[model samples]
Structure formats: C-alpha cells, structure tokens
Target chain A: MKRRRPFLLFTLLAFGYAFLYVPIISLIVYSFNVSRLVTVWGGFSTRWYGELLHNDQILSAAWLSLRIATMNATLSVILGTLAAITLVRFGKFRGRTLFSTMVSAPLVMPDVILGLASLLLFVTMEHLIGWPAGRGITTITLAHITFSAAFVTVVVQSRLSQFDISLEEAAMDLGARPWKVFLLITLPIIAPSLLAGWLLAFTLSLDDLVIASFVAGPGATTLPMVVYSSVRLGVSPQINALATLIVATVTLCILLAGWLMHRQETLRRRAPVIDIS
Target chain B: MTTRATINGSARNAGEWLGDLLTGHHGRRLVIALPYLWLLVFFMLPFVIVLKISLAEVLLGRPPYSPLWQYLEDSTVQIQLHLDNYRRLWEDPLYFIAYLKSLKIAGISTLVCLLLGYPMAYAIARTRDSLRNLLLMLVILPFWTSFLIRVYAWIGILKSNGLLNNLLLALGVIDHPLALLHTDFAVYLGIVYSYLPFMVLPLYATLSRMDLTLLEAAADLGCRPWKAFLRVTLPLSLPGIIAGCMLVFIPAVGEFVIPDLLGGPDSLMIGKVLWTEFFSNRDWPAASAVAVVMLVLLVVPLALFQRAQEKSEGKPPL
Candidate 1:
C-alpha cells in the first residue's frame, strides 16, 4: 500500500506538470512552422518573426503596453508599499477594517466588473469635472494600477509582517528619525519583496485585455487587445511567434531571478558574523 | 522644545505647514491616507457609480445613460430612477441562465482543480526541500506567462484540424475528428488549465506546513493510511482547501477570456454576457446592472476569502 501510494502520487505529479507544459511546448514548436496552417509544418522558418516585426499595429500596441506597464508598475509599487506599511505598522487606526478591505478587495474582483465600473467612473468623472477628458493610456493605466496595487500590497504586506521591529528600533536608537529609519533600515530589508511586487504589477498590466478593452479609447490599443482581436480571427503564425517570444522572455527572467536569489543566499551565508561580544 | 516652538511659529505659513505635515510627525498619516484615498476614488467609488448607473435609464447619448437627477426651472430637483435594467435582468431568462451557468461552470471547475491540484500539491509538499522548491517554481512559471497566450495555445490544439485531432487520427483512435473547440468542455478545460496553479500554490503552502507527526501517530494507533489521511491530513488541510477553492471559483465565475475564446454560442457565462452588453450591444445601463448583480452574488465569498486572508496575513497568497 505504501509503495502503491508513492507511485500514484508520482504519476499524478508527472501528469500535472505535463498537462501544464505540453500545450506550451506544442505552441512553441508550431511558431516556427513555415505554413499558414498551425497543424501542418512546412519546414522551419523565421518568416513569421520578420512579419511580426513589420506589423505596424502590433508594434505600436506593444510600445503602448510597455509604457502603460512601466507607469503602472512604478505607481503600484509606491501605493502598495504605503498600504502595506499601514496594514503592518499602524496599530488599530480608525477605519482600519475599511482600509484593509479596499486594499485587498481588488485581488479577487472580476475583470468584467472592475472594467465596467472603472469605465463608468471615468465617464462620470469626465462629465462632472472634465479632468481626464477622455479614456486612453491614462485611464487604462489608472485602472491597471488600482488592481495591480492590490496584488502588490499582498506581496509587500506578507514581507512586512514577517519583518523584525528591533532593526527599525535600533536605527531609531542610533538617532535616526522615523522617516530615516524607514528609509535606511526598513526599506532595504524589504526591497526584494518590493521588486517582486513591481514585476508582478508590470506583468499584470501588460497582460490585461478585458479591463484595458473597456477603459481604453480608440487610439490606445494594448498588446493584449491587438492579440485578442487577431486571435478571434483564428490562430496565425505571427501570434505564435509573439507568444514564443513572451514565453521565452518570461522564462529567462524567472531563471535569472532564481539564480540571483541563490547567489544572495550563498553570499549571506558566507558573511562573517558580527563580534557583538 | 526649541525646535517645536520654531516649527509652531513657522506654521503660520502654508508651505511650512504643508512640509511639516509631509515630512514631520504626520508622515504616518500620509502613509495611510495615500493608498486609502487612491482605493476610495478608483476602486470603491466606481462601484457606487455602477450602482447609480444601474438605476438609470439607457439613453442614446455620449455617456449612454439618462441623468438620475436634474434641477427643474423652479429649482426643485426631479429624481428619475429607472429600475428597468434590473427588471430586464429578471424578466430575461438569458441573464438568469447566464448567472446560473457561470456558477455551475465555476463550481465544477473549482472542484476539478481541487481534485487535480490537491494530490500534486501534496506530493510536492512531501518531497525534499530542493525538489519541492523546483516543483513549486514549475507551478508558478506558467502563472507568470501571458494568460491570453496560454488560452490561445489551446485553440491550436482543440480545433478540428488541430494537434489533438491529428494525433488521434494518426493513432487510429478515432475515425473522424471530434468536435472539441468552441464547446462548454473547452471552456472547462481552459479554466482548469489556467487556474490550476492558483489551487496548487495555496494547498502546497498549508500542506507543507502541516504536522506530519500526527499522521504517524494515527498510523501507530492502528489506523490505515487512508483512514489516517482522512482524519489527520484532510481535516488539517481544510483551510487550504477552502482558500484554494475560493481562489479558483471567484475568478472563474467572472472569467471573460477563457469562455470567450473557447466557449461556443450556447455556453452562456455571465462574464461574456456582461462583455457583450457593454461592448457589442453598447448598453451601458444594462451592463452596469449586470455588474452590480454579479458583485452582489460574489460579495459573500469575497468577504469570506478576505477574512481567511486576514487570519493568514503573514503567509503569502498566490
């Protein structure tokens, strides 16, 4: 029975990983197919990659998406770090429940609802104050920041909550002000989490299609928006090339992050202990 | 004391007061207020607008919703509230069925994810440290990839002349290509594939943290392995199960990309319904009403998920 259980588990694990990966592997292989049809491979070629590069619509959309993602990630990291600090450091502030709820609620909120509501809000704001003027990059970035900040807050909050308070207190004891202590002691300790949060927000903003579709105006087409429109017309080799590029880039980033983390671990272990005695 | 006196004396100037408020003792308040106000304006205020728009009549104008209130010539306010949008949702079986169908699909998908994910998570949790980390990274690696790309990959596999059909035909498993794409089954496959990581991560977390000694004690007490797992591991992992299920179910219910890309015309999910109402049909009021109703349906589970999250704040969530 014991041997059978391990075998069952191993099989299940193998199947699970295969289920997750096989489609991606097949898609990667087909990206190089010379034929227009996805099923038939007419030898290998880089023609689709060349075509993708020349597609003006896709290029512009990718540029717009990159800009929006950069802006969203930067703003989300700031707001998320503040929200995390509030939740972790502030002890029993007024409206704390509501504050925490507002911070976390966006994580599970449906994209359709969030999109519809945000679009309505932008319209109402425009009608009332005429601040935004119209929906475009600004509106989509704002919408992305709102939800992405929630995810960032979760990431930062977990790290902050586990942090030791004595480090900050020690900095304060050495005559550093509260802000200085936070900047010098607290921020450095939690910088890794902040980076993770930033990357997460960047990816989320870049990948969003539904919310961006709702909040975006005529000119501001994101990469996902362009991809969705083209994908609806059925699978194309260009999209496959684009997908392959995205998958490869992301995999490379993850591997780089993993290697950096491992090196950091080794460096920390090798550091000489302070002779406090 | 001298610095405080000087600061109080300088507080007569607005710039000094503002600077003091930002960099001085009120820094804590600034930290709390910034994100608090951002969410209030962007996240919370939008829901109020949705509720307001849901009560307004659909109009053929720029914003596409009639005014809820207007000042008459006599300066008396006339309030116009049209509940027809909500009423239409009730009268029209399409909206009702879509909600039901979304719930059914999300529920079934969540269950399938749990069944498939639980064992994998358990296996990973039981592995040695280095292998476990590698396995966990493998689960998260797909999650970091583009969601649209993942869903799009299935189209190439599920279409009539797709890879799966071709492979099956070559193996002589089927005489003809079976209809796979644009089906309810395809939607299920997409949801399970996409959300499987969300289920596994949380389950792995709680399962890894579980006390294995209790299982050993159960076995020593003459309990069979299955019986010990039922009593010890399964019950112990209930929180993870709930967390994992909610993570999968909440998003799956309102999932737009998966259903739209993979589902056929007959597959009526509320997210697609809402999308069509807003984008294709250009019915803002109706879409707002649909969103408000969907929010109402999800509020309880969302609150429960938050409570669980608050209870486990130090632990990271996927």
Candidate 2:
C-alpha cells in the first residue's frame, strides 16, 4: 500500500544496474587501450579499432554473419507471424497443443541440442536426398531461422493476442474480404510487433555461435565463431573494439526504436477520435 | 464456411479453387500448416533422428555413426541398435558427474539471479510509467548486445591481474590477485549476469499486473508491510517465479559458452561434454546419447515452464 519507493529496493536496483553495466563500460573503455594486454591500461588509443578494421578474417566473418542474420530475420518474421496467427487466431485447431509447444519450445531449448540436432537433420537430408549438398551459409541460416522464428513468434503472439478482433470483424462486415481485412486492419496494428520480432530474430542470428559452429561447414565462419576463437586464446584489444562496436550499434538501434515507438504513441494519443456512429 | 460451400458448388476451374483455398477456411488451415510442418520437420523430427543416432554404433565413416538399418548380402535386413552409447553414459562417471554438476551450477545460478533480479524487477514494476520504461530498457539493453561478448567481458574483470584484482589490490582488500576467472565462481557470475534480465522481465510482468488494493487491504488489516508482501505479493508472484527460474535454469543447464569460457578444467558441464564428444571425439552417437538424456532431464522443467506460460497468458491447459 505504500506508494513511495522503498530505499532498500532502490539501492538493490542501483546495484543490479551497476552489476549489469560495469562490465560493458569497462569493455568499451579497454577497447581504446594502446597496449596489447587487455587488463592493463596503457595510453588511450584507437589502434585496436584500426587492427579490427584490417583483420580480413573478422571482416569476412562479419559479412557472412550479416548476410545470414538478414536472411534469417526476414524469413523468421514470415514464419513467426504465421505461427502466431495459428496460435492466437485459429482457435483450438487439431494439434494446437503440439503446435503451441513447437512454437515456443525453441525459446528455452538448449542451443547445443538445437545445433546438434539440426546438424544431424542436415546430414541425414544430404545423405538421403542429396540436396543442400553440404553445410554452409544456407544450412546455418536455416538453423538460425528455426530458433529465431520461435523468438519472433513469442513477440508477435503476445501482440496478436492483445489485438481487438472486432476491428477485423468490422472491416469484414463493411464488405472487405478476409485477406483484405487482415491486410488493412490487422497488419498495420501489428506492424510494430513484426518489426520488433524481425529485430529480435536478427540480433539472435547475429549473436549465435554454438549453433553456427555446429552447422557451419569448412570455409563458412560467422563473426561469433571468429570472436570465440580469438577470445579463447585470451582477450584481445581488437575483440574489445569489436565488442564496443556491437554494443554501440545495438544501443543505437534500441534507442532509435524507443524514440520511434514513443513518437507513434504520442501521435496516437493526439489523434482525434473517429465517431463512426 | 459459406465461402467454402459456395466455392464447392460453383467452382469449375483450378483458379477458383485456388482462390477459395487462399481466402476461405482452407486459408486458415494453410497458415497453421506451414509453421506446423516446418517445426515438425526441423524441430521435432530432429529429436527422433537424435534418438536413432543415439542407438547406432560409432563408426569410422564420414558421418561418424553407423547406420541403424542395413541391407545384407543375403536376403535379410540387419537392424543394429547399439545401446552402448546410452549404457556408456550411465556407466561413465565423467558424464554422471557432468550432468550433476550442470544441474547444480544451473540451480545455484537460477537462485542467485532470482535473488538479485526480484528486487530490481519489483522496483521497476513499482515505478512511474516513464521511469519504469527507461529502467526496463536498461535491464534489457545489455541483453540485446552480444551474449558472447557480454560473457567475454567478465574475463577481463575476473581474470588474474584483471580489473577486479587490480582494484582489490589498490584497496588492500586482498594481497594476492584472486583466482576468479576459469572457476566455478566465474561460471556462476557469467550465468547469473547473462540470465538476470530473463528473470527480471517475467517477474516484472507479473509484479506490475498485481493489484495494489490487495496490499492496501492487508495493510488495513493490521499487517506490517513486509508481512503483507510475504503473504500477498510473494504468493501471487509464484507463477512468475516458476517461469523465471525455468527460463534461467533450462538453458543454463546446457550452457556451453559460459562454462567453456569461464570454467576451469574441473567444471564438467554436460554441454561442454557433449560438445567435446561431437567435435573433439567425433563421436556422434555419444553426443546424441548425451542430448537425449539431457532432454529427459529437462522434460519436467520444460513442461512446468509451458504450463506457467499458459497460466500467465490465461490460456486453457491442454
């Protein structure tokens, strides 16, 4: 019943945030260190960033990862939206239990299992059908899509469930076809969630390492793979630079998204109400 | 339904039938069928393949696992089910210890995350809307960054002569740099850090939706604030607690990166074991066996998580 914030809880929150951000802040700080050693601070410089830029392996891997992430994001949004529609709109179809489980299970399923199982599937498919020929970008993208779509589905499903069905019904009653109603009424309303889903899938695919490692064949390496190999030997300043870049990009994207959503919210609030009656 | 009837009654061409299928009841079926078939083939069927592979012998072939079925020279079919993979998993103390350690590590990390995250989530949930949004974003912002990178960041902090040690030395907290990285403690720190947001978001969802009036009633009934929280808020947040714990515990159990990066040689998590089996040993059957067993271990928690999700969503249990 106390409306005021508790001091202990607020302190805890501060500590929690500090715990979360300190490593990141430090990582960013060390990225500019001139010294090769990660722990010690030599003078501040951008040498690692320069080294990172010139590293052909990291660049090629980053390019490959970006391609996979883009394809995975686009494909996941489609699959996830359909899955969300099935769960939230279809209403108690046969195998709805299994369908729902399949849609969400990937979110919590271990990445190692997913990676291993998917690799096995591709191997079997290659042996049986002789299609896909061998694992590469295509296989990695497919594996990413499978799990990333689950994340997208969760995002879209929550939005779809909150949607007002009567809007679509009203459009339908006014002589619009089902698809037309969906396109004109439902799509616009859920577009924000779709965008969120797409971004989530994209980031997930980009960040994935274990699954990509499992499914990637010889010659196909992702950014995370390169980072993992380098980081394993010990922390490198170039990796610190790469991490700083990733953190900066992600932070920028999130802030932009937040601003866009806020603007949309304000515009919606300011819009005059339509009196159809 | 009427559309289907009308199409059946009047459709005399493939185009009409296709249109009906696209726009009518069958279209709904198609929407459901696409993702369903995709998951069935890619998600569910892989487990079946893993099970089959788990039953096969390790081989010196390209695939590295023997075929489950073979056609013999004579008029006979040979079915080889090598149960040794599973038997070896049970018999081997290395795997047994790894599984136990994985569960133990995941359990402790989940507990730690819950402890650290609950108050944070509650604070955010109880805040004004604008501040709440900003706070929640802060919590999730790190999550949006690369998970591997975030985990990698800890190495600099926890390693010998790392930031923490240097700071500690300067502060006279300890004379020697602590052996923090590549230890069980670092693994716990990494898991808890990475999974804290997962715990917080779900808890905040439940906590924010909680009715303050109930707390008010408890307060009016001569109850202390802490007691009111214990009796009312804690009980109400059980679903979130379960969901959050499951979310943290499930993947953490099979976490490969945290352990591989931060854990010492003694940290024998099943995920690391499975990875070594598949990649280092090139024993697909052993890896498949490990996966099958891990799935079995997680089946209960996974079900619990699904139920909690359905409950939170106000959906009927299947």
Candidate 3:
C-alpha cells in the first residue's frame, strides 16, 4: 500500500490539475470554431478574431483599460515602495499599528465594499476639493491604486524582510548620501521583487470587475465590463477568442517570470564567496 | 572643541536610545503595528461607515443622514438599528435562504479543494529536488491568467451540449446530454477550480517544512504507515489546514462572479444581491446595509477564528 501510495497520489494530482485546465483548453479550441452555437464544431475559422479587431467599442475599452492599468500599476509600485520602506525602517512610531492594519485591510476587505467606499470617496473628494471632478478612468485608476498598492506593499514588505540592513549602512559609510545609497545599492537588489509587485498590481487592475464597475462612469467601460455585459447577452465565440488570447499571454508571462526567478536564484547560489582577511 | 564633543556625544546618545527603543520584543511590536494601523484605517473604517449607514434611513440617493440625537429620539432606533436590517432580511426569506445556500456551496467547494489540493501539494512537495520547482511552477501557472477569463472558460465546458457532454455522448455512455450548466453544482465546481491552488500552496508550505525525523521515529516504533501519518504528520499540519480554510472560505463567501456566471436564476448569493442593489436597483442605502451586514457576519467569525488560533498558539493574533 505504501509503495503504491505515491503513484496513486500522482494520478489524483494529475487528474485534479487536468480538471482545472481542461475547461480553459476547451474554450481556446472552440474559439476557432465557425459555428455560432456552442454545440457543433464547424470547420476551424478565425472569424471571431476578425470581428474582434473591427469592434471599435471593444478596442477603445481595451485601450482605456490598458491606460488605467498602466497608471494604477506605476502608482501602486511607488506608493507601495514608500510604505514598505517606512514600515521596515521606521519600525515604530505613533499609530504604527493602525497604519499596518489599514494597509492590509484592502487584502481581505470585500471588493464590493471597497468599490462602494471608493466611489463614495471620489464623490466626496469632488464635493470638497472640486478636483478629480468627474468619475471616469481617472477615478477608476485612483481606486485601483488604493487596493493594488496594498497588494504591492505586501509583496515588497516580504521581500524587504529578507533583505539585510547592513547593505545600506555600508553604502552610507562609504560617503554616499541616503538617496545615493538607495539608488545605487538598495534599488537594484529589490528590482526583481518590485517588478513582480508591479506585474501583480497590473494584472489585478486589469482583471478587476466589481470595483471597476462601481467606479466607472460614462465612456470608461473596461474589457471586464465588456465581457460581463457580453456574457449577459450570452456567451459567444468572441469572448472565447478573447479569453484564449489573455490566457495564452498570461501563461507566457508566468513562464518567463518563473525562468527569470530561477536564473536569479541559481546565480545567487553560485556567487563568489568573499573572504575577509 | 568642548562644545563640538558635547554635541557629538548627545547625537550618539540619541542614536543608541533610538536603537534601544526598537530592539527585541519592542521591535516586534513596532514591526507588527504598522500593518495593524493599515487594517484599522482601510478595513476597519469601511465597516464603520457601513455600520453607520445601516443604522440611518434612506433619504435620497446617498447613505443615512439622521443625527445621532434624532436617531435616539425614536426609542425604536436603539434596538431598531439591528432589528431594522434583520427584520428586513427576515421579511425576505430569499435573502436568508441565499446566505444559507451560499454558505453550503462555499463550504462544500472548500472541502473539495482540500481533498484535491492536499494530494497535489503533497505530490509536489515529495517530488525529487530537480523536478520540484518545475512542478510547483506548473501548478501555479493558471493563476497568472486573468480571473475573469478563467471563469469565462467554464461556460464552454459546462454548457448543455458542451465539451464534457460531447465527449460523453461520443463514447456512447448516455443517450442524452446532462444538464450541467447554470446549476449550483456548476457554481461549486467553478469555485473549487479557482481556489484549489490557494489551498495547495499553503499546505505545500507547511508540508515541505515538516521534519521527517518524527515520521521515521513513528515508523521505527512499528506503527503502520497510515498510523504513523495520523500520529506524527496530521497533527503538525493542523495550522496549515486552518490557514487554507480561512483563505478559501473568506473570499468564497463574498465571491460574485462564479455564482453570477454559472449559477441559475435561483442562485442568490449575498455578493450578487449587494451588486444588484447598488447597480441595477440603484438603492445605495439598501446596498450599503447589505454590504454592512455581510461584513459584520464575515468579520465576527474571522475574528473568532483568529482569536482561537492565537489562544492555541499562545501569541497575539496578527
């Protein structure tokens, strides 16, 4: 029984994973179907992709989403980096506990509540300051930044935890200004983690449906919103085609990230040992 | 020269004092505090707003507007605050029933994920060193795909005449295609598909970190393989089980997409209700109330779980 256990376990594991991915594989395969109804597989055709290309609404929504995601990702990284640095280095100050909790709250808080509260915030900010005057891509991007930064902060914090403080101290001792030390020594080491965090933020913002729906105003529909509305109309081959492309792109990115991380780990392991005389 | 030395001495004193202030137990407190503040402001504050709105009446499109004293004047308001929503919720049996249904669906899905993910995580963890990283990476490959697209893919698989049915029919197993789409079963399947990786990763973390010495010792004592696992391994992995449950259950309860996409019209999870109130109905007050109640229901249990874990571990809960 013990000898067969591992093999049994592997089979079960493989089956479970296959269950997870097969639906996705099916969707991708059927995206090329010429048939409109989901049942029959007509001869393979790229008509859906052709239709998607000319659909101005979908293209514009995609562009808007891309712009917002890019902005949100960049802003999230900057703010998250600052927050992570402060949390790690400053360690303790007045209301530190409160700040820590607030930062993490976004992670577990229901998306519906977050979206509603953010919409409320945007409206209130408009009333008070008469700035960010309208709800559109700007407000939506701002909202995404709030939660996405929280996520980035978590990743950056974990990365920073494993980092040594002495690297900064050594730079400072070698006649480098604080900014210079951060730029030269600290930033490079944490670059991969920062990149990872940015990617995470970007994907989250891009994938966001509930929050984006809440904050979006006229002319700010995203790819998710489009897909959601279209799904309501009924699942079509166009959506399958879109999903296949997204899944393919993301899978490629994940593979690249995995390879890059592995290379970095191996390089770190093989780094020449310094002998202190 | 004397002044300069004195100034330098004082500066050095201040630096040491700062260092002392943040060292040892005090340092851990400080390190943990920032996260606490963040949760308090963003997480705690939103709930506070929800609670405040839940109490007040719907005047216009905005949340409640009643002053605290005015609210107090109606003695009904005191107890009515809680009763108002609960009464409203009770009046609509649909809401309560939906909650129960959602809980049942989420609960079963979490269990399914545990069964599937535990073996997968174990297999990956027990793999040879060279293949371990590759296997683990493959396991998480789906997560990088957009969540929406992944869920969207399910429509093709679960539809009436979809892939599963097509394949089954070709094999001559059944004369008719099974009704698989727009069912509670489909909802559960979607949820488990999405959340399985979450359970696997945590279990993997704990399992890989597990020391083999105890298991070896148990085996040496002539315990059967299963008996050794029960006595030595299972007990050590309870923490991971709890963590995985929390990770799956918390978000699963609030999930909107899976149910909306896969579930039939009768499927009415609180998340979808909340969305409908906000978007379709445009009743902001009612939506806020629902959002408030859901948060309360969710947070109380989670807090209790955290407290329980803390008590067991004999540490303050993070």
Runs of candidate 2 with Cα error greater than 4 angstroms are: A272-277, B1-20, B73-75, B314-318
lDDT, residue A66, model 2: 98
Query: What residue pairs are clashing in model 2?
Result: none
- TM-scores for the candidates: 0.94, 0.95, 0.84
**Better structure of 2 and 3 per lDDT:** 2
Query: Residue A21 lDDT in model 1?
Result: 99
Q: What lDDT does candidate 3 reach at residue B216? A: 74
- Higher TM-score: candidate 1 or 3? 1
Tens digits of per-residue lDDT, candidate 1, A1-277, equal 1324478888999999999999899989999999999889899999999999999999999999999999999999999999998888787989998988887678878899999989999999998999698989999999999999999998898889888898777766776656556666677778888988998899999999999999999988999999999999999999999999999998898888888778866875797341211
lDDT tens digits, residues B88-150, model 2? 998989999999999999999999999999999899988888788999999989989999999
Cα lDDT tens digits for candidate 1, B291-310: 98999999898988778677
How do the residues A56-127 of candidate 2 rate in per-residue lDDT, one tens digit apiece? 999999999999999999999999999888877777877988887887689899999999999999999999
What TM-score does the A-chain of candidate 3 achieve? 0.91
The TM-score leader among the candidates is 2
Ten residues in a row with the worst lDDT in model 2 chain A?
Answer: A268-277
Query: Per-residue lDDT for B48-125 in model 3, tens only?
Result: 665655565555533333323244654655333433655687689878887787678778888988888888888887
Question: Would candidate 3 be rated incorrect, acceptable, medium or high by CAPRI criteria?
Answer: acceptable
